[model samples]
Target: MKKYIPLLFGDTRSIVGVGLRACPKRATTIGSCPYVRMRSLKYSIWVLIMGLMTFFTTPASAALDIEITRGVVRSIPIAIVPFDVNNPNNPNDIARIISNDLNHSGQFQVMPQSRLPQQPHDADAVSADLWKTLGLDDLVIGSATLTDNGQTKADMTLLDLFHSNQSTPTVLMRQSYTVANSQTRALAHHISDIIYEKLTGEKGVFSTRLAYVTVEPLPNNPRHKRYSLMISDVDGHNAKPLLTSTQPIMSPDWSPDGRSVAYVSFETKLPQIFTSDVATGQRRLISSFAGINGAPSFSPDSRSLAVALSMGRTNPNIYIIDLGSGRLTQLTDDAAINTEPSWAPDGQSLLFTSDRGGAPQIYSIDLAGRQVHRVTYLGAYNASAMYLPGSSTKISLLHRDDRGFNIAIYDLQSGTMQTLTQGGYIESPSPAPNGRMIVYSTNVGGRRMLGMVSSNGQVNIRLPEVSGDAQAPAWSPY
Candidate 1:
């Protein structure tokens, strides 16, 4: 029997210690050199230690590299003092939610609560000198009180600490709101929106919602799976399922007003387009043509939907369906496969995928004259094109090259394409309502998950890891 020694460094494990030593007779020259044998054993032990370090430290090193590469380099420094709560066990933390929202935007760097010198809940209590000394340019202070009507009343003050001559912190904005306990999160998001807009010249999308599809394996059967359509806050909190089925649901598009979502559901063994109200879960079949009916996108005015339908033909073509009168108008009448139609900001034309150019490429079509023109010529493969918010000349789409499929933004004026992602099968690029970020789905270790990248290709973030696979994210309007 042999005894082994085990060495542990934190959570890592490695074997150490020398094996049993034996010495042979001095028949051969220097056969009984135990010192030399011990030296070899010591060198072998050192090699083992180095190997253990490589195994345990590589992952952490890689994580740090990722953080540095994806982090915002020039973020504004700010702080959010924890709100004074009337009840210690109150369910909502308004200040914390606001802090997370700002931090996640990649435009602001929020100081940790532990490093805050004082917790101020009012404008008069904020110490401009203390905050300026800490190198903070701005601070947010708020207080939450429980009302007699079982609601919470919150008052927030945004202070700008740049003016040193001012005896008190300069007030940038002040807002007060009263809402039920369940609505506290929404109120916090509204506050974040106000602060963000005041700092940045652009409107904030913190109060917007996200719609996505999640897939998970069945409980008792690993071979079977279940799909769910879910809606959540912009920060991935308070997710509520709208529909779940064994069949697949895909291509969710939010309406202009953010009251309804249109998607494709395969419930009857055939793909059909359906529209559902987000609040009441009431659904209506929008398109169930004889052949392929998919990719339903709402117009800017929300009066009609741009969809792809085969109409018993061999190839799918872009069609516009009037929601009010149930009238169908074909937009593209070509032998090429045209689908994934996205409306322009003006709603006069659309950008859609067409294989008429020998490979999948984006083509722009004018609804009035029915004129078609190639929009993407830089790539051999480009699809799923959508206009970035507030920009009619820039569009985001999936591009394919030697690097595989990636998200790329194309400038129509410059005729140049800039790749956003490094290419890991990234798909479904949906720009946020504020046009600051684009959310897509990518393959992570063979599992599909949601990810977001800034419009300028500065910040990248992966949504929080959860039990199921999340995909097909749609950003709601303001």
Candidate 2:
């Protein structure tokens, strides 16, 4: 038996070790490689297979710094007043959190605290004429009080300032919440969601969660890195590690119910699929196949997983494993590489990547009749495809063009593709539940960080890490 050391770098693979190269523009195959028996792997796997040599144990934090690079030309102007708090020592800023959440969505232009004309905790105290002079359309006023029962009570009122022929602002919505003091941030996010929905007519993702992989070098050992699977709020707060290891973790997919996450881990020096409970740290082994086990995606019902497995073969295939019975059903069996399975909204079919057509492209496979059909033809390379929320006629995928690898939206109805990102280093594009925005990993200044782009290409935001590199962001379903 020959041992292989994993190297992280370019597309070149040698006999000494297996290299987790960056996303290549063209298809590649490993010919007669002893370490990795698979014939070919997609660029999604390339973005996934990082340094797998050694593991070091250390704590890693992924506090994200958000920077908006691009925004819409005409965003809704809104004001969020500083909430009046009874306890001055309380650290949570409910108003600030709501302001940041609305601003980051790219649909609203939030007024700065210093620019606000006045601070009012009640809608009746607000001057509609003064806000109309400031050219604001909406106003949010709230108060958070620490009650005597060791709980926090929050009140929020959304006021519409631009009502037709109305001198006084109309109250659109009013809500109250009572939660533990520690959950004040969550309450704030809920309030933001309510305000957004009342104004935009679409559901807001402020209360959703994000799951990603964060890697950092160990304190004592710079040569080894610590990889951790983390879960955080949509705004990148309350980040807590679900699992941390010296090995690499990749391709995290949240369950539709948001109870568990399925991912590939190399803790045992080989790839294996596991699902960890989001609330608790309990993990259950899903796949331990001999040759390869990667790219685990949850079914719509969350009772099954569509995973890529080699099964001691030279080429990988798609398989469906029942979570209850552990029964494995082969979906595709061929010499061509099939991986990166994404379940359809109805769960009757799946979209996967395969090179059977000479280049990597998105293909659909029906589970009932085992029928396969090619979906994309405009691009020479298209992989990592998933259907956008609420729309089956379109998909979001990583497309390679003359400009390099970027995020693109493909329309199945018109057979056209629209590239979203200009930077060629983008990968692992994950769409939010509402299909208004997407979050993915990109290389910025030679460091991997998370970024977001609105569905219409009007906004771009970078979630730069404070310390480590973040990748493979999975947006949780609300």
Reference-based lDDT, each prediction:
0.79, 0.80
Clashes in predicted model 2: 0
- TM-score each candidate: 0.83, 0.85
Best-performing candidate as measured by lDDT: 2
User: Which clashing pairs does model 2 show?
Assistant: none
Best candidate, TM-score-wise?
A: 2
* Model 1 alpha-carbon drift over 4 Å, by segment: 1-69, 86-92
Question: What overall lDDT, based on C-alpha atoms, would model 2 receive against the true structure?
Answer: 0.80
Model 1 clashes, total count: 0
**Candidate 2 off by > 4 Å:** 1-65, 86-91, 164-166
RMSD of 2: 15.7
